[model samples]
Target: MTAPQRARSAQPALDRVDRRILDHLADHGRSSIADLAEAVSISASSAQRRLRRLESEEVVRGYRAVLDPIAVDRGLVVHLAVTLVDHTTNTVGRFERHVLDLAGLVSCHHVTGDVDYLMRVDVADVEALDVLLRRTLARLPGVARLTTMVATSAVVDRVTQV
Candidate 1:
């Protein structure tokens, strides 16, 4: 974990006020303590106290600016469904370790079902995708097969809403 990231405590029961604070912060990440207090109908000091508690408890991880993929030259998004040769701990560990070296990796999930892992990758175009598939993904340890799906469009996600 990074310096500001703490290991989360056992799921803390959230009250209505906490939920409201989180819901407000989800859409307005840059809200100041005063703004957050006003939005949540709490005192600034209470907002500060609660926000600090949330951060220390790891419920509020950290703030980051969400960037547009096209603005960053990564206009194409591809889903890679990866099937490993086996489910041995060693095989899974090695495969996951290798995936960390891959560039343009937006997210990776080790999931159940036919595929062992699903990775979301962003690239400039098909040629870049081809390079990633042939040069990087194929060479990952214990990778038995890969299925690719190119996304035509992205749907908006409301991730942190209560």
Candidate 2:
């Protein structure tokens, strides 16, 4: 099966109330149960119950502080189109495991395309990216080739809305 197809097939359906809770939570991750209840027009206990359900179901993965990358100095974003030396399962698994230990790896997707994987990397600058590509990614096992595209600007970066 295609990678996108697999992702689409795995999404669980959410009801109206569940969607409302998610929307509110997306806007305010640190919102109290009482506050969420008020926003969603439900009782505190009910909101708590639904929140628990969302967590258990993996609908709400985890809460995190979304900081400005530029402010922290890791502003440069690069999307790498990577081709593997082989299409073997072992090679793919090894590559995946190895990239996890890499410092600049933002996200990696095993994709169905000319390239075996697409990786998003964030670094402090072009020099840092050059070092990453040379010292880290290029030397990784099973990496046949890599094409890097620097993102000049992010037109849209958002969480999935309910």
Candidate 3:
């Protein structure tokens, strides 16, 4: 099956309350149910039920602590444009599997345009990036070429939709 088909089949639709809970979490993951209820304008019990339902449905995957990459010493942020030599299902699958296994690859999106894939990568330095390119990315089966753009500043990186 295609990637989009596989993703859609795995994930279920979100209800209104579920969406509100998700939005609340996206804005502030540590927000209590009482606060969340106040924000969503629902009773505390109702908010609890909605949050439980969202969790059970996998709509609310898991909560995580967002950290500063630079503070943690992972200073380099690279956006990579990856073009595959082949677009067949097998080739795409192989590339996807390999990309998923790579440690420095933060996010990978199968995108349209000249490039087949867009990858967000993070590393300690340029040396680490070189190692990632040579040892990890280059070893992938169908990768034809990769072009990288390093981010100098983060203008906006919002987790929640507004």
Candidate that scores best on lDDT: 2
Q: For candidate 2, write residues 1-162 as lDDT tens digits.
A: 999999888877788999999999887999999999999999999999999989998999999777778776678988999999998999988999899988867789999979998988889899999999999999999999999999888887552221
Q: Work out candidate 2's RMSD over C-alphas.
A: 3.9
TM-score for all models, in order of appearance: 0.86, 0.82, 0.81
Candidate 1: residue 118 lDDT (0-100): 93
What residue runs in model 3 are displaced by over 4 Å at the alpha carbon?
1-18, 159-162
lDDT of each: 0.87, 0.88, 0.84
Question: What are the runs in model 1 whose C-alpha is more than 4 Å off?
Answer: 1-9, 158-162
RMSD of each: 4.8, 3.9, 3.5
Tell me the lDDT of candidate 2: 0.88
User: Number of the top candidate by TM-score?
Assistant: 1
Error in Å for residue 4 of model 1? 22
Residues 57-148, model 1: lDDT tens digits: 78899987767666776778889999999999999999999898688888999999999999988898999998998998998999999999
Residue-pair clashes per candidate: 0, 0, 0
Q: How close is candidate 2 to the true structure, as a TM-score?
A: 0.82
| Residue 104, model 3: Cα distance from true site in angstroms | 2.0
Please provide, for model 3 over 30-98, each residue's C-alpha lDDT reduced to its tens digit, 9 standing for 90 to 100.
889899999888999999998887789877788877777766656788899999998999999999987
